[model samples]
Target: MSRKQYSKELKLELVKKHLEDEISYWKLGKEYGIEASIIRRWGHKYETFGEDGLEKQNADLCNYSAEFKKKIVLEYLGGNITSQDLAAKYKIHAPSTVRTWIKQYNNHEDLTNSRKEGVYLMAKNGARKNTTLEERINIVEECINTGCNYASTANKYGCSYGQVYVWVRKYKDKGIEGLYDRRGKNKAISQLSDIEKLKAENRLLKAQTQQQQMEIDFLKKLDEIERR
Candidate 1:
């Protein structure tokens, strides 16, 4: 499924609500059907980069100096900041972009300027490949094991980055059974066996627990940064 797009005006309005109105992220998210983390990200970007940060990123690839990338990667590795904060500070398109750089740095990959911008563009925005269930499982597993580097995993599997991200999210929320193609099927919870239902519930609980812990960590870090 394609990801939903929000307008610039709407994004600004939501950010303002969080910033100016003192509305909680969870309340806004529940009312708007967006994840609280996403809303929080928007607010952070707006704070860091102003209105321009609310704009959708262009598909055109961005080139960064090797030195610049190394600086950010090292800062991230220093454990003083989150990838999302670093992305906002540097005006990077997304936190995932920062994570990709960190992944490359950890793997001893070259952090050279993108001499082949077209290849990066195609890899990021090209047509997604249709893969078998086995391939999807393998891709999801590798993505998880590799620190959830969706960009690299997508390139490795010849799929769109969005595909890798969505698959991993689904796997987290529903387990291995979620990776199956269920288009045009209306499988209800009532139709599931007891074991299947229990497994799905467990997966959902696990995902929620992880999200809660991440939020807690982010808030604690934010407090520390503010104190400093």
Candidate 2:
């Protein structure tokens, strides 16, 4: 069955009815043709984000810093504000963004790492990088020393500015341990040093250069034989 989408105005009306009229979720679902569970979720989002929580968000439209996400998640968990209210306060276009952050925090997932790097969200194109724990610590420290200059830190570290910003925020919120890569199963870059990474890249470049040189020499020999 095709899922029905509700408009912002409709969602607001429904939530208001649920709240002011104190109607049951089952009754609301029956009246609106939405499931009780869905109504409950809507009610929760309404409490968190308000009317804006009902609006759909464009996936490619925005990128939020890790610090902002952490703050929102913590605030929601703290029970002081709804996700909708937090979204409005932060000027976040999507309330669902807060929902995702809250879910990940509850799951004990590291929010510092971008999903592209196997964290939470899809990586921006060609922007994903493998950074070690030590490197993450250094990056965060440098960002702090530079007054949280994320762009400069990212340039110095050859990483995305967004990634650097996240690392610094995570460090401040969770201390040094937050920078640690927690995935035990996918540990390809674990415990590796910056020097080791550079050396590996250098080795690959040298091998490619040698192969190119060999091809050039073979072409030269072939040309001479053809001239004969």
Q: Model 2: residues >4 Å from true position, as ranges?
A: 1-126, 185-228
Predicted structure with the largest lDDT when compared to the true one: 1
Compared with the true structure, all predictions reach lDDT values of: 0.67, 0.59
In model 2, the Cα lDDT at residue 4 comes to: 74
Q: If scored against the real structure, what TM-score would every candidate get?
A: 0.47, 0.29
- Scanning candidate 2 in windows of ten residues, the lowest lDDT window is 117-126
Runs with alpha carbons beyond 4 Å of true place in candidate 1: 1-60, 65-67, 75-96, 103-118, 121-125, 183-228
Give candidates' CA RMSD values in order: 11.1, 22.9
